[model samples]
Target: VAGQFGKSAVAAAPTLLTKELTFNFQQKRSIQLAMVELEDMPVRSEAEELVFSLLIAILPERLPEQTQLLSNYPNPFNPETWIPFELSQDSKVSVTIYNVAGTPVRNISVGYLQAGSYVSQLKSVYWDGKSDTGERVSSGTYFYQIRAGDYTETRKMVILK
Candidate 1:
């Protein structure tokens, strides 16, 4: 690959790169690949310049293109609710619920989730109207925020009990 990095023009010996990737997904995706390989083996950066591109990125079906926090199900609930969201890339997900007064009422540790749509009930986070200390919460209006990679969003929900 030959292109200007910034102000310097860099070129290298012509080498072939075989990359197999398919991403049939919803709108909104970012994909970039850069590496150096020679004859199915690794090559020093000083030896070559190449950019890898996938084929499925041009299609549309299997992956998510951006991170997002969708609305929760049964927003006005009795004692529990499910939070559904999606990620554009692999990330350590963290969910925190805050009361109307802007104080955290519950913190959900979601650990790691792969890049995809987690819109289904089974894939979403479940909060049993309880705080981190495992006590029931008196709810009217509450805020739920999710942190996935560099993306964050907060939505409102109600507990009718």
Candidate 2:
């Protein structure tokens, strides 16, 4: 899938008839892709300068300044949702879900996590609309509180039937 210099060059390489991917070349092909031709070679640069430029170009988003709780997805969810947040530093984390009457329903203890992001669904805390006793919760308003070491914050969400 590699593209040419600023231009898209599309051609199929030799592949087997099966669904599995292949990297080895076979001599049974009739057509072939263009061969790579280089007119100039790479010039050597300072290691620090190359590293700094690469970092600056690739790292556009920095770490969070302060640890805090972020909003959960699909506020009025049916069966499941994810809670996303970022941490300023390493600390133990926990998420507790409470009902409208302030009674705790679920508790998720996320041991020690490093300082970074838990914002993506794959890395964030997940709730399956179940209580700590492993029973599904009813449709209603719910509050979630996050405790990360010395930092604490709370947010609200809703569950739908």
Top-TM-score structure, candidate number: 2
Write one digit per residue (lDDT tens) for candidate 2, span 43-77: 43454334333333333244466898989998889
Distance from true position, residue 157, model 1, in Å?
Answer: 0.5
For model 1, how many clashes?
4
TM-score of each: 0.63, 0.66
The residue-by-residue lDDT of candidate 1 on 1-161, one tens digit each, is 24445323221211122124343323223432121122234553533332321222222234555788999888799899999998878899999999989999899999998777888779899989999899899969999999998888999999997
Instruction: Go through the candidates in order and give each one's C-alpha lDDT.
Output: 0.71, 0.72
Residue runs of model 2 more than 4 Å from their true location after superposition = 1-54
Provide C-alpha RMSD values for all models, in order.
Answer: 10.8, 12.6
Model 1 global lDDT (CA atoms, 0 to 1): 0.71
Q: Which regions of candidate 1 fall more than 4 Å away from where they truly are?
A: 1-60
